[model samples]
Target: MDHGRPKPDLIIFDCDGVLVDSELLSCRCLSEVLAEFGLQLSVEQALELFLGRSTKAIEQYYRDLLGQALPDDFLARLRARVLETFAEALQPIPGAGAVLSKLQTPRCVASSSDLDRVSLSLDVTGLAPHFGDRLYTAQMVRHGKPAPDLFLHAAGRMQADPARTLVIEDSVSGVQAARAAGMMVWGFVGGAHYRARDGRAILSAAGADRVFAHMSDFWEA
Candidate 1:
């Protein structure tokens, strides 16, 4: 007997903190970059503003923070540093690989990060081969997370019905995007960036179908 097919036709995963433990590394890299300009920012501040956003959005945020225009090449330098740091220490979140390996449904990665960064993270975490050609980036959509364009774009590209997709996200912005795209959302709370009360509130306000405190919890659910 064919188990009557799984519930969701597709499973879309967020790359950064959900699949790879790169959130804190990203925060640290940006903080170090800002320090070069004589600006100091806490990890929490970086997470609040930069997590789940595109590089362009992150550049705009620094532009506002510095009260002046950033050099056009600033983003390039930042990207290089982030990539180097991630390559040196990148690892998958606890149980991430096992969970992915156990899934029976078609899976795809949809990330707010640029294609290069997304590819690098997945490569380091050893999840690149698992996804094959099913990677979707914010550049493929009209807008990033908090807009649903990325998730919708991924679903459309996969030819999967949006109603039958399940989005696994670790940020409120990502969860909101998936919800707006008409897919079920599962909020991942096992990452370092989402340890605060505000993070929990954001997940709730965004209407996550379920909040998982651990990878095992998600797998069990």
Candidate 2:
């Protein structure tokens, strides 16, 4: 542990943009699927509206925005599309492997994605070995990001105190959730989706304790 600064007893990670460069790809696919329902959005817009959110929450946002519920099979179709796309396109965040390999403290993944998506992402990116079975997902909790439930759940399961845990996230919702969980947060901006976005400002405004633009910084932090 780096004792020069406040070292956390546990380190929590968000999946999509933090561990994998899947945000842009996911947004692209989501935008395409949303168009089927007469809801049109560009990839960037989709990322802005739905990044770090669960599929359920994404559906709710669309429903709330359009004032109508999606078709019964809409999410099913969307999920299938996502799975296929991920199987072909998913990649890990640059330098993420090095950081994960070098980390000395306890670490785990807590993501808004379901277990299948998380597992597939890790497997596709060749990062599964680094995480093993230390995966947490929104499906495991009653609430998702922006609610603090998943992070708290992961910390509790890991036997780490909330106040002593650190979270690395790449989205506003994830940052808010970490803060709500009483954990220190670092906003990550190294994913492809963040290159044209001021993810630092967005996440910091949402209460992240620090902002880092690369996975290399994770090792230093």
Please report the candidate that would top lDDT against the real structure: 2
Residue range 73-186, candidate 2, lDDT tens digits:
888888888889999989899998999888888999999998999999999999988888999999999989989999999999999999899999998889999988888888
TM-score of 2: 0.95
lDDT of 2 at 164: 90
For candidate 1, write residues 123-168 as lDDT tens digits: 8888898898899998887788889899988999999999889998
- CA lDDT of each prediction against the hidden true structure: 0.83, 0.88
Per-residue lDDT value at 181 in model 2: 87
TM-score of each: 0.91, 0.95
Evaluated at residue 187, the lDDT of candidate 2 is 90
Alpha-carbon deviation at 102 in model 1, angstroms: 1.1
37: Cα error in model 1, Å: 2.3
